[model samples]
Target: MTSPFDFDRELAELGAAHLLRRRRQVAPLVPPMDLQPDQEHLRGTTYLIDGQERLSFGSNDYLGLSQHPAVIAAAQQAAARYGVGATASPLVCGHSPAHESLEHELAALVGLPRALYFYAGYAANVGIVPALVGKGDAIFSDALNHACLIDGARLSRADIYVLPHRDLAALEAQLQASEAPRKLVITDAVFSMDGTVADVPALLALCERHDAWLLIDDAHGFGVLGAQGEGTLAHFGIVGQGGVAPEWQGRLGRLVYMATLGKAAGVSGAFVAGEPAVIEWIMQKARTYMFATGAPPMVAEALRAAVQLILAEPWRRQHLQALQRQLREGLQAAGVPWDLWPSDTAIQPLVIGRNESALKVMAALDRQGVWVPAIRPPTVPKGSARLRISLSAAHTGEHVARLVEALRQAA
Candidate 1:
């Protein structure tokens, strides 16, 4: 039986390399309001990890609407009406009014004609990619795209050409070379690990020239970038059909936009927005969407509230920008012995060259009552292991100062 698969040896190897992943039971708050983020106190951003309190920089709740009174109230109301679970697939009576409303709002926000919601970002990508492209097609992917996108490309059974990250010339050349029946280009709007943004307008232009489909996974951009928090498209002034703003528009030929609500929106689930016909095609053909149970109606309602908060509370984005500058300036002044990679977004990566060293830094911060995740390969490249410090609007200036001080001590 091939030596019983050698589970123990494989696990031991993983452990030895400082890459064995483990989960600590994390309570979202430090007190009895544990399930909720305490958004009004000095300990507002604290989390109870394995029963120990730690000021955390490990969450993607960028706009901090997860525990807003309005969001919570909306969820409570929906749960009272529809119960907690969606109870069925969207095709089998699970697509409720809340979901439909949320989808419409999402489409309009992104300037697309329609949108389809998914239970998670991963599911959306893995399903949408294969739904629209298959064996005879070709997919051009960015090297640093998220795992979900990579998995989707692999599953599509299409010819995948992975160009170097952000190498537009190489991508163009590859597109020029591919003579497949159909061509698709896939990339992350904001790379998860490094926090660098893709040149989306240029990519879209290239796709148009080559008559290819462009898919942008905006997991890290939605609710974080743009004047109205409309994600990366808004940041670059690319508006589509049904988009109300008179933002800059190009020939937008064929594009598919996907963004998650769980990150900056501070809720659960994701949505794919594009032309109505394309969305209908995905809904009709995607196995993940057709077979899986929909997210609860309460989640849909909560996301509605989150969407409103995103549009109404401009201060959150402004405050976030201020905090980013503060953190960057403080760290540069401290001369911390690691590279703080450049980013214009909320996700900040401090690159520590070796795996063990990154973990050491994480441990040091943890000991100082602060928590940031040590991200190692295969999440990142082998030598570029880092502590991915994610900030949120819930965090205060004092919180940033505390983290800076702790890092200075660790250094």
Candidate 2:
């Protein structure tokens, strides 16, 4: 029963290159016997990693809705009414009123006509791309697109042209030269690892000119961007008018909007929003949608509460901005040589360069009871390994300062 594949040696090679990823078990800090006033908020940003309490700069709970009492209560109530599991695929009787409501709210939140909910963001992309374009079609993706988009393009059987990151001119050049009958341009509304945002308005314009569909995965942008956390579209003053914005209104048909509920919304699923006809087509044809079991009703309900919080409370985003400024300023004052990317968003990347160096810095912080992970190659390009410091509204100013000091000490 000996396997032909040299798995051991292959793994050893990966380890040697410091490219092997290890998962650290992490969980909330159970409140102390003598608890503080805002223990729930403290719990969300602090974690017990490997039996030690640590300040976490690795979470995507950007607005801290994950710990909100309302969100948790909504899930509990829904569970009592509808039970825990969804039992079957959406096409086979798993879809519920909760799912429908979340979808509708999602559509309205993004200023699109309709929305289709998916159990996961990855499923949304892989399913949507293939449903939109196939063999004779072309997909022009950003060179720095998330893996889901890349996988989706591959699944579509389309000719994929990866344009240089943020290079609208190059994207336009390809669109102009392409002869494919159907074309799709896919990008992340916010580049995840680098913390940089896509110029979505420009990308949308290009897609419009080329007579193509623009699918933006706003996983990092949703619940974090915009004046009301309406997302990246609103961030650019282009989307979210309930279809009344004159300049971008006519072009809404060409835009396929998608965002995750997990990061900023503090829930566990994703949804695709667009024109009714287009979403209908995707819902009908996306294999991931057709076959996967629906997310539990509890999740849908919890997301509803999360959405309300995102709109009702503006302080989360404001505090997040303050934290961003604080971290950047602190790092600058410390004079760290590595570049802190020019990102005003919550995801801040400190490029450490080289796998060993990145891990070294990460380990140094771990020793200081800080839990910011080191990101290495394939996640980011080779030689650009970094510490992707994810800031959350749950994080305090003190926490940011502690991280800055830890990083400084490590440096």
- What TM-score would each prediction reach against the true structure? 0.96, 0.97
RMSD in angstroms between candidate 1 and the native structure over all alpha carbons = 2.2
How does model 2 fare in lDDT? 0.90
Query: Would you list the clashing residue pairs of candidate 2?
Result: none
lDDT of each candidate versus the true structure: 0.89, 0.90
State which candidate has the highest TM-score: 2
The sequence of per-residue lDDT tens digits that candidate 1 reaches over residues 1-411 is 558789998999999999999999987664423443434753337878998989989999887777677888899999999999999999999999999999999887777779999999999999999998999899999999999999999999999999899999999999998999899999999999989999988998899889999999999999889887899988887863336345334455488999999998888999999877889999998888999999999999999999999989989999999999999999998889999999989999999989999999999999999999999999998899999999888899999999999999999
lDDT score at residue 8, model 1, on the 0-100 scale: 92
Over 4 Å off, model 2? 1-4, 31-41, 241-244
